[model samples]
Target: MSGPNGSETMPLFEAVHDQIASDEDVAALDDWLRDNPDGQRQYLEFVDMQHEIERQIAGVFSRGPDSRTENATSKAAADGFLFPIHSVRWKVFAIAASLLAAVGIGWWGNSRLDDKPIAAIDLDASPVSRVLGIVTASENGLAYSGRRKLESGSALRSGRVDLQSGSMKIRMESGVELFLAGPSQIEMNDPLQVQLVSGTVTAEVPDSVIGFAVKVPGLNVVDLGTSFGVSLPANGQAKVHVFDGVVDAEVERSQQRVRLKDRQTVLFDGTSVAESSYDQDLFVQPGMNRDAIPTTTGDVRFLHTPPTSVRVGQFEHDLVLCFKERTESTLLETDLPVSLDAPGHYRVKPRWQNFGAVPRGTLVDSYFIHLDAIGPEKRTREGSITFNRPILGVVFSSSLLKGQNEIFGDPRTAYVTDRTNPKSDPTLENETITLSADRRTIRFSWRIRSRSDQVRVFVAADR
Candidate 1:
């Protein structure tokens, strides 16, 4: 007679029996039913009992009870329902039995639904590619934007790596490796493709990754199993250099494609594209240190120049020597010991010694000497230094050595020099240096030449 909240629920029972409950009252009843599940089962049973009683009464009235015995049995049935409703224990038992029957029917219906077949579903059809590689090495101050910071052994996925400074290397899953120089942006499209937005990168593609491709601004370079380098300068020109094997390059706008073989190169601007022979010495390798020179022979001597002095009448010069053997080259520089009392005059002995059997092709030896005049005054001082090695190519910038001007040599030799006066203007001059068959040694002399405080001399030889 009382609810769990100590409020009478008799009003709720009367509203259900009348089959006319207000919306608010129905909502309240639903909440009450949730709080009291037993009450819900009892309510359902009560409603069924009321409907059965109404049917029985209607049947009796329709039949118009032909005899007193039928009328008496019908009256007794109606009275028996009243007795069960009044008895609390009997009402509980009847409600429980009805609830069990309803539950059993619901379970049977659910089982029938379960027996029906369902369409199969595939869960592994996602469209994401697998991881390709990891960042194997990274230089200090290596910053990246638009993605996570790149560190050693960081797993690489499909995304753009924008480097602000320093360099990094990536070891791919397909046995391909990449050395990405700083100030570069690259998008890892997949294991087979990369998009180079700017800067430079050297790729070492093995036989397993023959179809590896790099997409530049206006061009696409497809490797034919090669070690190559690609650079995109700020001017929007793309340059591709193939070290070994071959590659197919295509222009996106014109659909112009070309096959580049070993030691070949191509340049692609927005308006035009050009091809030429590759220069192996143009780029430094991945882990090479430009300051340290390599020695090609076992008995090679090392020299070092004293630190430039600020005192009057003091000058200094550093020498760098390069020896080429096959496709590889070795660099050596001066390693002189430091001593304040030591005389400025010193002799360097770099004898032309063949350490090993030279390959068939003409072997060339190159030397680069840099002189710096460090003194109290900014004015230039006259100085003279001599080299025993033949002078071949001379230029201010190394790029000028790419045959921009012919100075001295005829077509038969490598002794080419710039003929411009070493004074008048200190800029790079187009001068020529003559060579004799016995000219194994040469001398450089400066006489208070303006802006000659810093001079760089390049010497090359071919045998």
Candidate 2:
């Protein structure tokens, strides 16, 4: 009942050393060790003393009972007394010491293992980027619908974004912003560079991201602290239009470089390059309420069965005018009003308010026209068209070129009228139309005669 201090109670230290302590009893011993540093040192010393006693008891047992008895007899003769070698108390003490020694050695080994240092982790070797941007907005359909779902605040990594039908906006970590139009494919190479594989993208690169580069098929467009637009169609050349500041474009194959300043435009088709006047109203900017009017130009032939209606941009233009076989007239009239939603954008409605089905093998003429959403202040209006099919000829007129109107199959190909005769050909004198190298698109620059007056675009096709 009495412990080491001669009190009428056993201490926690004695209970632990005697191998009679439960988990809760050992936990109490741990609390006492924390509050008293001298007590902790004393506990370790008691453990060492117990280990030494166990070692001595093991040595006596290993010598065997016969050897121990001989040694005890010699000691007893010298001391004039007999020693009991096989006493029960001595045997019990040896057994208890051996068990305690095994437990102490195991606990010491575990304590040594806990004192070992852990390996450190290096964060710089991580695979993920340090700062990632988020998707701000998305419209239409994503190119990679199965890869990952795109939503607001979705973190963007280095991957290709195929915008099949709509547009998307991204805000980068470096304060650079991008407005990507659909039918476009782009790759995020890093926070600083993006490769425009196909389609159109407008970049608003701030001062922080001045050197941001856009890699096209055959050229590298490096931003020089500016906002610019890059468009690359499937079959056409890549175009770089600089709205502000400067841009350096270099051909990858030829190493030919060109510097474009503010309001400058350049086109590179792998082998050749050309510069032109930058048209600001050509592309739709971010947050602009604009719509593209769809028109078809080039070889228009009547199908035996009416083809499926095609929707271009955001509107549905379903009315088809087909002329029947052996029809004397090549024209058909429609009463539908083609109303455009945007203010500055133009829409074409048939002059006649009646539409009739045309017979098979009838030739139909059409033209593709694009109107700018720019306001009236811009006196010079420009439009561009990329044909899906080959175009035989194109014509322009202030009024609808109805019956008896002059038509130009090959306009400006030859000098038909003298320069002095101004009244002879007034139509060709006012407007300037330039055709692209591919002959697929025609860029028209017209002087607006009146805001209320409408300009008509016509294309002639053979059956």
Candidate 3:
């Protein structure tokens, strides 16, 4: 289609839009665009329109888990317009795959090809902004920055967002994962830091990304490789709680910096900061959300493709499955058939691995990670799980796994098990069960040549 005499209809514009522009045509179009301010103005308007379309598309994908249930609208056309690539999914390998792979590099950043930016595409929570964080998980989540709402997978930039209601989790580009509770607003200062304007956010920082920080009114709490929580209540002072590892906290007004350890607390009031008693109930915990675990159906995977949902015999693709078994049980007198909660690395080895025994008075909850297989796709599969609370232990032995069929295992779940305890056979299933050093996550590799593979984890209860 052609435009009026010297606009989008120009041969040079057509060539660029068609992606057949020669070096000379590109140079000519650049020169013409520089001289024709009106032409530039008109194109800028379309870019802005495209920017809005991008936000609307993100809104479609961000509704958290609810998005899966909602029908997807017609995907926006990837015409020569600057289309951003958030990564595309290519299912199945075939001869026709190459024809369908119309992957476009960050079309949004095309205008910035040179040091000079043609026009800046600014939208609240747009992935185009300098990537600071990405929403990884949410529960009944509703967040807003100005008028734009943020859903799961929306990028957090160098702006403020008010999580008006519900809870959400963010994984910073620097690898710091934070859980934000609603009615709270936060300002990301940079890749390594954020300022809490209101509400509570708990961060789990790994060693590689040490020095990641969270700032509140008068305090700047920097993780020295730690997991910590910061809270700023409505019209209240800022409080910091270090759950594990260490944090160096500085009071802006007083110029005092203090290093805090596990279970320590710090309270800041814009002028003075002092050590305080730890409040265990100040932040989000397991069993607080609709699902006690409030998990993302998508498990974070490191090697191989992530698991997709399927039934017992439909092993068309790899699977990542997590189901809540015995939730919120204060099994004071009950002995778990099989489980381990100690923070360490342990493979699914029989007769050699250790399992933690909970004290008689401790409360407990259990979740089963089951992998069902048959036919050919019944080989090896990998997946992981992160508990909202600390884990007491994990049990995978067939005897221990089956013994709990009537206890922690869901009575309704048709769990497959051998009548006699089958010892761990490394050859049959080279399964591995490893918990992160912090005990917040468990990674496993399971192989099932028949009915199913099962692993059970017991996490601490909120009570």
What is every candidate's alpha-carbon RMSD to the true fold?
35.2, 36.0, 15.4
lDDT tens digits by residue: candidate 2, 378-422? 345444555443333333332222211323211211211232232
Q: List the residue pairs that clash in candidate 2.
A: 324-359, 335-353
User: In lDDT terms, which candidate is top?
Assistant: 3
| Model 1 lDDT per residue over 397-443, tens place | 32233232232111222222344332322322222122233333323
Candidates in order have lDDT scores of 0.47, 0.48, 0.58
Candidate 1 regions with alpha-carbon error over 4 angstroms:
1-129, 145-147, 276-282, 288-463
Query: For candidate 3, what is the lDDT?
Result: 0.58
1 against 3, candidate with superior lDDT: 3
State how far residue 407 of model 3 sits from its true place (Å).
26
* lDDT for residue 343 in candidate 2, whole number 0-100: 18
Better of 1 and 2 by lDDT: 2
At residue 407, give the lDDT of candidate 2.
34
Q: Write the per-residue lDDT of candidate 3 for residues 1-463, one digit (tens) a residue.
A: 2332554546555566556988987776677567677868755665565554443333212222223222221132232223221222111111122223445344323222211111111111233444556665556778876676775445465568789888877766555677888878887645567778888999987554545778876678988878999999876688899888999889867789989999899888777778888787786642234436533323221111111221244322234345565334755685554456666665555454545676667787777665554346654565567777887777766656666656666543455445323432112135676787877788766666554566667778887
The candidate that achieves the highest TM-score relative to the unseen native structure: 3
TM-score of each: 0.35, 0.35, 0.39
Question: Model 2 Cα displacement at 35 (Å)?
Answer: 77
